[model samples]
Target chain A: MRVITGREAVREALREEMQRDENVFIIGEDVGVYGGAFGVTGNLIEEFGEERVRDTPISEAAIAGAAVGASLLGMRPVAEIMFMDFVTIASDQLMNQGAKIHYMFGGQQNAPFVMRMPAGAAEAGAQHTQSLEALLYHIPGLKVVMPSTPYDLKGLLKTAIRDDNPVMFVEHKKGYGEKGEVPEEEYTIPFGKADIKREGKDVTIIATSHMVFKALNAAETLAEKGVDAEVLDPRTLVPLDMESIVKSVSKTGKVVIVHEAPRRGGVGGDIAARISDSEAFYYLEKPIKRVTGPNTPVPFSPVLEAEFIPSEEKIIDAVMKLTK
Target chain B: MELSEAKKLKMYRDMWRIRQFERKVDQFISRGDITGTTHLYIGEEATAVGAINALKDEDYISSTHRGHGHAIAKGSDIKEMMAELFGKRTGACKGKGGSLHIIDTSTNNLGANGIVGGGIPIAVGAALALKMQNRDEVVLNFFGDGAMNQGAFHEATNLAAAWNLPVVFLCENNQYGMSTSIEKAFKIKDLAKRGEAYGIPGVRVDGNKALEVYDTVLEAAKKARNGGGPSLIVSETYRWKGHSKSDAKVYRTKEEEEEWKQRDPIADFEQILIEQNLLDEDKIKEIKNEVDAEVKEAVEFAKESPYPDKDEIFDDVYVDREVEL
Candidate 1:
């Protein structure tokens, strides 16, 4: 086992996949000699050559559309959007074309491309900071992946490349620097599975991406307060591991869903609805709670941004309300 | 660039097939057998047939909303196309894609896009794939005058030129982009010159002349296959019918429509074949009868095909993974 940053883990996954499959290539802005805006594709061009590690002009629509088109022709292209917010510029290709191509074309073709987007608030102002996983999750054909640790990032990214469908791989900007243990041997995690970060008995705290760490911290504080809270991460949003979510919620009978995205139309609401709609409804001792960012643009001020992103205090507060 | 007699006759036959197919589609829409509206390729048949004919059978093509002509030109089974328009399980898209999205991957015909300029980047990507694999096959991207305005066209063309990918951008300038004439939409008369901005060679041809289009595209495709990079070919033509079935004849004058109709590509090509002794009156009538019979069979096949089962609606969203709805 080796400890590495989430960024290094992603680069490793990409390098390994590129070596395994000649069809795999990277296409995006600043991915080649520039190494990517976040440096997740660091020095890949030096090893794989410019052909496999393509650097494109500042064209988001074409980048996404090219990935879809190349995928239809049997190329596994991994397209990178510098920021998640810019994905809006590429939404037509991702939503209208790539997401609907397989179903619309009567299964004659499938767009097996991975669109890597760096998301979450990083004090980069309103336009640059936003978690758009909800937007991608709503699309039927897209598989949404958001990993919390280096291990998950490495495993899930490899799986996304091998998937025979469009995958929106959302990486948290702040989580890139976070370090975790990863095995030296190759591995891949399957979709539709949840990882319980911390096992507990009194309450369940569901989170995703950067929010997973916040929930874990909140669980640590809750444990000292004599309230044991379970922390669960539904790693993939589209093929949501509701079985794991409902099982944890049924045992605890109290739930708090946390995410960095805004509360209105957020994935938390969907999880809440699913819990209420399932057999877990009878086991609930309290109404489901949500600790999410308010419905407004992320602020530029560090203090405001700190408040804008859901914190460990917010998670603990929401959990206490349900537990007490 | 002399073409064989068989190839010339095929160009004429494909042009006629598109004309006759579109005419039947008009009848089907009027009779309420086809529900959704379609952008008929009545007058611009030569551009599709001629450009597609210029490519090898293994080459690929990306089409537009008015795509029935391109599909036929690229050898898609008309029965599947008709069944798709009729919304049956036997359709090219299994009844999911209507007239707007008919795709036949078996024929290397990438699906027709409902969005203007949407297929441009996809074609560029396909070309990118071919180039990466070191394949000699080229891709012919078919779009309209309207798509030239889209940002996608600029982005895709630039990428193709920058990478020297094997693709030919064939713009069918059939006058109007849904009521907006090219005169009002573009400042320049020749849309081909736009290729200069991306540093690719541009050529404008009379779309009514099938042989001219074929010659121009053949040269471009050859250059692309030889690693000379992408080119832009603008085929200036006109759409005889309205933009769609729902459009009333109000944008242009009837005199203008009749004037363009006088240069009907099918009739013009038929006359050329006759002059070359490639076809005679008897052969022309026989070809018409054969095409008419084929069109009739396609209609009957489409009419008899079953609608997709309701439960099958959940299929094809993903290849191997099933998502919980």
Candidate 2:
């Protein structure tokens, strides 16, 4: 019903959720007064006041630690990490404490919170460009979500806000500016459900975040080459939609898992393994292919950095190898 | 000296309970009945009992890894704690959290953290919660001397001081952090000075004396409740045993241990009780026996309790995990 960029969708999600719940508040560096680093929280401080939209000192540990502590006391806190790379500074609070609290306490408490970080490669060099969704997904008791479209971003972010468990919601920096038709009315996308962007039968192309766009682009190119590819975008990584992948793999009899993260120990490997383990293996006419970044740090140079992330050309090459 | 006889007697009883409980846990852990590393609070009973006694039932306390004494002092169920240490299904955290993670939210006793200085920020946050809620309750963050050097300690202290939150940062400087002496960790011998940097009043108290710690905490708690902001009470105490169950006490000599043992908190309290004629020897012995029996009953209950089911690992991760498309 509405046409908005991914950034606007995220801003709307935070605003709506903050307005809906009294206990909910946003805290991060430059969130208030200066607005968020990505401008997603622009003018929110004026709207919600400084109490609800707080700007914190540059302490990831403190921000995350306070959020965890606040969440423990029945507050729904949404913390922002300016870049996904900086989350390393607060990994202790995130992985050791936040992720373990609910399970360690044996259900006595839950860290009902959301951590928003701008992830993926754009112009930012090696450190800022890395997408570490796979690392977070590896941890238990955490919901890791990456939304591709504005509609999914809005709905899924709202869902993450209300979720009782801690959610690591990673937004691609480049995807934020991408325009999409988001509903004027409110909506929420469920976790672990795969969205089939364009259904085909030649190969099951599973992607996430920015890679969804690339996969769709590759799908169009593959159509010209007479190779129909079914593109599936799984918004969440933790509660992954294995059924959708398995079903598509069953029909297509070939698969390609694509992600922006490094190929070594990447989510693509996990998806490929699941497909192999599932009953869909019998239908496989060709072995599964995984299109991922190389096992190295994201490069500083734009050309090398672009190579570090998966590309549509590589997807096309992998698809041609499988389709042949 | 002007404290009521009832108050004096109650302090003696709680201190006796903590001493008895720690001793029993030591024996149980040594006998292999209780699994995992146990941090005994044998010599530092006064620090926990006295400081905790100063707090109200609703007041929150963030505990350290050597937290059994603090937990017991904060009114956590001994039975559940014992069961948890035994890794039983009916434990405080359903046996997932062992000796170090025992927590009872009902009693406002936050979970003991494994990482050193981890609970400081949590305590500060809890105090901030109280402030936001406009509640009169105060938070007592219990840490050791070694935690003073941790980044979390500095960050938490600075934040608490800046916010003027209702919290008492009770540093139980028990001579050593594991085997490393506090003297070796810092240039200044005085631990209270570290708190002064944060612009809050810091007090150095005799950790061996229950009355001293009790009075100090009473003042701090009162100040916090009255919106006077946070204070640091560095209680200089000593641990009777090594840092953990496996420690051989290689760092300190037998003489050093013996010297501190002479000023034993329980013995010191017992002497006070006798001198004041508040509790006779027979009454003290009766209290000790009652504590011993209670500890024994908890051990029995833990031994009888069943281990948690294997499938429980997947459960309790979150409140809900609905499949969404």
Candidate 3:
């Protein structure tokens, strides 16, 4: 086992996957020489050479289009959108062509590629900071992944690269510096499985991406107040871990969903609605609450952005209210 | 490109077959047997047959909404295509994709696009894959004149030129975009000149003349296969009917329509066949009857085919959905 940051874990995953399959290649803006915008794909070009680690022009649509075409023909292309906000440039390509090709052609096509996007707020202004997991989850064929730890990032990312489907690996920009122990041996994490970060009986805290750490913090703070909280991290949202979520909810009989995205029309609402629809509804002791950002763009100001994000205090207060 | 006598007759026969098929589809739509609307390929038979007839079936071709002629020319089954139009379980896409998205995997005909320039990027991507695989195959992408204005065209073309990918961007300029005149859209009469933007060779040919399309595409295909990169070929044709079944065709004049009808691709090809002594009048009549019977049987087959089951509606969305949540 080795300790590495989420960024290095992702690079290792790409390096290992490329070595495993000759058809696997990397394509995006500045991925070749510049080592990716966030330095996640550093030295990949040196190891794999330029042809395999292609540095495309600043064309998100072209990158997505090329990835879609290349993957359909059995070549695994790992495309990177510089930021989640910029994915709008290629949304049509992903939403329309990449998502519907197989079904529209009667299963004659397969878009087996991974699009790595650095998402969520990282002191970047409104244009650069946005969590688009909800939009991606709404699309049927596109698989959505948001890993919180180095281990999960490597395992899940490798799986995404290998699967014969289009997967959006949305890495949290803040989570890149977060360190975790990853196995030296190769491994793959299956989707739709939730990790019980902490097990308790008072309330179930369902957190995603970077919010998992805050939820963990809240659980620790809740322990002091005699309110035991359970933190569950659902790594993949599309192939969601409903069974695990309901199991946690059933154990606790109360749930709180935490995410950095806005509350009005976000993925948290989907999870809350699903829990209400599932067998967990009868087990709920209190109504589900969402601790999320407001329905507005992330501000450029540091104080305002900090206030915009869901804090551990907010999570703890929500848990305390449910416990009371 | 020199063609044998048999090959030349086959080209005429394919063009005739496409015309008959389009006519049958029109009759079916009018009679309410075929559902939904279609962008008919009535006057552009020569453009499709001339291009696809010269390329190998393994070579990929991305088509536009008016795709039946391209499908037929690229060796798709008329029955499956007709069944798809009828929305049947026996359809090419199992009734999932209708007339605008017909696809035949047997001949590697990529599914047609509903959006104007959507298939352009897809074709470029396919060519990139071919290059990456070190395969000698080429892609022949078909779009209308109006799609040239789409951003997808520019991005795909620029990338194709930069990467030196093997693709032929074949434009069927039928002079209108759902009743909007091409002249109103662009100032250039020869739309192929747009290829200069990417620094690739662009050629224009009389679309009503099928042989010209065949030779031009054949040359492009050879150049692409020999690492000459991509080229754009614009076949200047005219749409004889409305864009779809609902088109009023108020944009063009009756005089203009009559002038184009005088150069009907199928009729002119028939005349050429007779003058070349390759097909006598009796032989011409026999081929026409054969094609008529073939299209007629396709309609019959589509009529007999069943609509897809409702259970399959959710299937094929993904390769696997596991247990539904």
Q: Which candidate should be chosen as best, given lDDT against the real structure?
A: 1
lDDT of 1 by residue, B1-325 (tens): 6789888888888888898999999999988989979999999998998899999999999999999999999999999999999999999999999999998989999889999999999999999999999998999999999999999999999999999999999999998999999999999998999999999999999999898899999999999999999999999999888999889978899899999999988888888888889899899998899999999999999999999999888999888655796
Candidate 1 lDDT by residue in tens digits, A70-175: 9988999999999999999999899999999999999999999999999999979999999999999999899999999999999999999999999999999988
Model 2, A221-273: lDDT tens digits are 99999999999998888788888888888999988889988988888898888
- Total residue pair clashes for candidate 3: 0
TM-score: which is higher, 2 or 3?
Answer: 3
Q: What tens digits encode model 3's per-residue C-alpha lDDT throughout B180-249?
A: 8887999888888988989899999999998889899999999999899999999989888899988888
DockQ comparison, 1 vs 2, better candidate: 1
- lDDT (Cα, tens digit) per residue for candidate 3, span A1-324: 679999999999999999999999999999988999999999999999988998887777788888987786779999999999989888877888888887888887778888999998989889889998888889888889999999999999999998888899999998999999998999999988889989998999999999999999889999999998999999999789899999999989999999999898899999999999999999999999999999999998999999899999999999888888
Q: CAPRI verdict on model 3?
A: medium
Docking class of 2: medium
Off by over 4 Å in 1: none
TM-score on alpha carbons, each prediction: 0.99, 0.96, 0.98
User: Candidates 1 and 2: which is better by lDDT?
Assistant: 1
Worst 10 residues of 3 chain B by lDDT: B316-325
Q: Report the first chain's TM-score for all candidates.
A: 0.99, 0.98, 0.99
* TM-score, predicted candidate 1 vs. hidden true structure: 0.99
